[model samples]
Target: MENLNNNEYQKFADKKVPKPTYLKNVILAFLVGGAICTIAQGVTNFLESQGYNEDLCGMGTSIVMIFIGSLLTGLGVYDKIGKVGGAGAAVPITGFANSIVAPAMEFKREGFIFGVAAKMFIIAGPVLVYGIGSSIIAGLLSILFKG
Candidate 1:
């Protein structure tokens, strides 16, 4: 190590780092994300076929998907899926569910109030706040602009 100059050390470090396989990651993300959406769509279609209205079908499907996401997270399967699917597993509503539940599960040893309840919103809290704030602002703007 002492014999190496700065440039030589830098070159050695660069070579030692593994390169990312962008194409394979992209394909995996696409397939995993597509499969998740397909499952949601299937649920929606089934609800619709049973003569439910559009709103009900959409709501039911969301509830089902969130439950599935939470269940998978609890079972420790979602993390593996996340490793394989990358952003594909994370871009869906299920990911939002995972974000809430994962932290709670991790912190549960501290007790329910300080651990699970408090930490449950660690990730999703900011998202929820921003989403609600934006919607409120948009609603106000729409009301003010109404002719």
Candidate 2:
């Protein structure tokens, strides 16, 4: 029996394991993200064509996107998309909905208060906090320097 050093073992394992397709994954992510954004733009355009102003169209688009994300997540379709789409599926508003819903679904057995409700925001709570905090800081700075 021979004892392999760390470097020797790593080399052995490296040869045994196949390399991942990094470029393929990047292209998939790009296509998925671009598709999501394109759909959103289409929704906005459709709304505008219906005689809605830009502001209303934008809000309508956001609402529709969020609803679609939540619906896909609830139906378990978004998980499949995420597994293949990687960051492409994750960089959109639908990804945000998936983040919130995934935890709640996973923890639902522990009761609503402690599990579903509390853990639902585990992924997104920090994002909301910092986002709001930064907006506040930016507003204050603008007021102080520009006002």
Task: Give the best candidate by TM-score.
Answer: 1
For model 2, the stretches where C-alpha displacement exceeds 4 angstroms are 1-20
1-147 in candidate 1: lDDT tens per residue? Answer: 677799988998999999988999999999998999999999999999999999999999999999999999999999999899999999888888999989999999999999999899988999999999999999999999993
lDDT for each residue of candidate 2 in 4-73, tens digit (9 for 90 to 100): 5889888989999988889998999999999999999999989988999989998999999989998899
Reference-based TM-score of each model: 0.85, 0.83
lDDT of model 1 at residue 27? 100
Candidate 1 residue 106 Cα shift, in angstroms, is: 0.9
Lowest summed lDDT across 10 adjacent residues in model 2 is found at: 1-10
Model 2: how far residue 140 lies from native, Å: 1.9
The whole-model lDDT of each prediction reads: 0.94, 0.93
lDDT of 2: 0.93
- For residue 28, give model 2's deviation from the true position in Å: 0.9
After superposing candidate 1 on the true structure, give the runs of residues whose Cα lies further than 4 Å from its correct spot.
1-16
